[model samples]
Target: MSERRTIAIAGGGIGGLIAALALARGGMRVLVYERAARFAPFGAGIQLSPNASRVLYAFGLGKALATAASEPEGLIVRRGRDAQELARGPLKGFMGQRYGAPYLILHRADLHTILRVATEKEIDIDIEMGTAVADFALHKNGVTVLTERDHQLEEHRVAALIGADGLRSTVRARMFGNDQPRPAERTAWRALVPADQLPPEFAANNVGLWLGHDAHLVHYPLRGGSVINVVAVVADAWQATWTGDGWNSPGDKDELAGRFSAWAPQVRDLIDSLPSVTRWALADRKPLRRWGEGAVTLLGDAAHPMLPFLAQGGGMAIEDAMTLGRCLVRGEDVAVALRKYERLRRYRTARVQREARRMDRIYHYSNPMAALRDMVMGARSGQKMIERYNWLYRHKS
Candidate 1:
């Protein structure tokens, strides 16, 4: 009988955990090395589009995910002055029904728990917490992942090394050298409020978006309508950090109101209502020259960290895990699998990168003429607008 191959997954974020779970369940011996000491499953909310939710449903995490998630009626894009919705469409679960899944917005910790619980059920996943990969050496047969402590170096010649590690991936950095990630010209301030804390208008289940001059806001419910998560974005003069301190940070409520003072009243009311908020600058990397080298290859944010305008960052990473597993499971030779995986993912992710960058201008449009152009955008009509995203939101592979 052929022996099941061994796989090493670096980084324990959503991508790493999901890849580990997928591979282990596929009958591969798996060991996941997370740099953190323990996993508390913390962080704010994230949106799971159909492209991603289908995979979660396949994992049987739908009920758990749904409990902590909410599907907005639609995405309401508004013009700043009067808060008049510039466009409205069926974007959440409404769009998901057509695509075979749902768009779910849930607290990050909840989804983490769901994945962790599912993977721990029957999989022998050796999760080495508080362990960071110091370096690596790759060969034809397998790869070695090194950490700071000497006692845990269990070297094995595996079939492949999956770098599900994130944007600042140590594996990719060791192989490709440290190229600087470009700073996106915007920063984000995120906050969450108890449902009752929100006014009656916001208490209703809906996702609200207020598009302004060089800024925008996204708000929706989470934890089965118990809490509302608000993310405000604005163009800034400086670049921001990637790793946040975890959880929402305290901010000046009046200052928060000041930033959006010119925005529509509904937006101001929401910001003004928040007792506290956390702010961070948004950062992104340009596309890598290539994503794979020998037996070591990249996945998720390590391979592509686009702008967050599409709300697909986590969803795309989940898609990466599924697509990569599909490629790897198709063959006996691991190198062939890795190559196929990279080929399948690059084009789609690159196009997403471009589209995300294009949205930067859309959110930051300050000129009157730019407003007119968008006010009558032809892309809003017909299936073309929805169809254009089909290549992304509708793909199963």
Candidate 2:
């Protein structure tokens, strides 16, 4: 019998988990190393548009997601100060029917749990929590992931190593030494509260985006509409030192509430309603010309991090996983497969990264520019509005 090749993945995040499942389905033996002691619930909610949802479904997660995620009726764009409707784009039936898959919004923990559970069920996969890769050594035949657990050095050999470790990836650091993430000069305050704590409008089954000067707010129901996930991103000074604390930095509720005090009462109330907030210093790296070196490569944010303005960070990572699984499963030369995967994804991911930056500017436009943005949004018909996102949602891996 031919020996089964093993693929090692660092950072068992959503992207890593998804990639593991995808590769296992393609008959590759897979191992995942996660630094967390357990796959605990962290972070806020996320949106899984059709492009990503379809990939998860392909991995046999349709029913799991159907129950854990809420399909929003549509995306409503509003003026942050007065809450005036700027544009409405359908999502639930419209996006699903149009794109052949539904657009889902769910708590990050819920989605993580779903992926974690699905990955655990795979026979060809193994997961090691509390294990962090210290570095990697690449060779012509395979790669070795080096780690130290309990004061002992451990080495893992695999046909390829995927650095899904996210923004501050150790694998990426080994490949390209001393590359740091560039702050987008913004901060995000995220919180999830019970739906009943919010007013009916805010608790509605839709994705609501309130845009203002140098700031924006997004909220939607999650876990079958029992809880509402809210995120407030604003242009702020980089208060926290660029330590290892990339995201999940502590935030003060008073400071967050005060930031939105000038907005409409309804918008302001949501910020005040949170018991506390988790602040994340928004940052990203410039798109790399290549993703990996030899038998090792990068994935997700480790390859191309971007602003969340486009809400496609997760989607892009999910897309990368699917393409990667396909390329590796083709049984081509390991180097060729890794290079092929990078070629297939580099342009699209870079484009998304650039578009996300563009959105950051547009969403934070002030005075005349903001007014002009509202005018343009209001002018686009509902269908036309959806059409703008078609290129994003209709994508299939």
| Top of the candidates by lDDT | 2
Backbone clashes, each candidate:
1, 0
> How close is each model in CA RMSD to the real structure?
2.8, 1.5
Across residues 269-377, which tens digit of lDDT does each residue of candidate 1 receive?
Answer: 8887776787665666887667877677888888898788887788888988888777776655787788888888888888888888887878778878547745764
Query: Any runs in candidate 1 off by more than 4 Å, and if so which?
Result: 1-4, 149-157, 240-251, 377-388
- Assess candidate 2 and give its lDDT: 0.87
The CA lDDT of each predicted structure is 0.76, 0.87
Q: In model 2, which regions exceed 4 Å deviation?
A: 1-4, 239-246
Point to the candidate with the largest TM-score.
2
Clash pairs for candidate 2: none
Candidate 2: tens digits of C-alpha lDDT, residues 1-397: 1223789999899899999988999999998988888877778789888999999888888898878887888889998888888888888898778999988898888888998898878999999888898988887678877976665789877788999999998888988886778888898988889988989999999999998888999999888888888999988856456465446677899988888888988998888788778888888888998888898899999999998988899999999999999999999988789999999999999989999999999999988998899889988876788788778888998
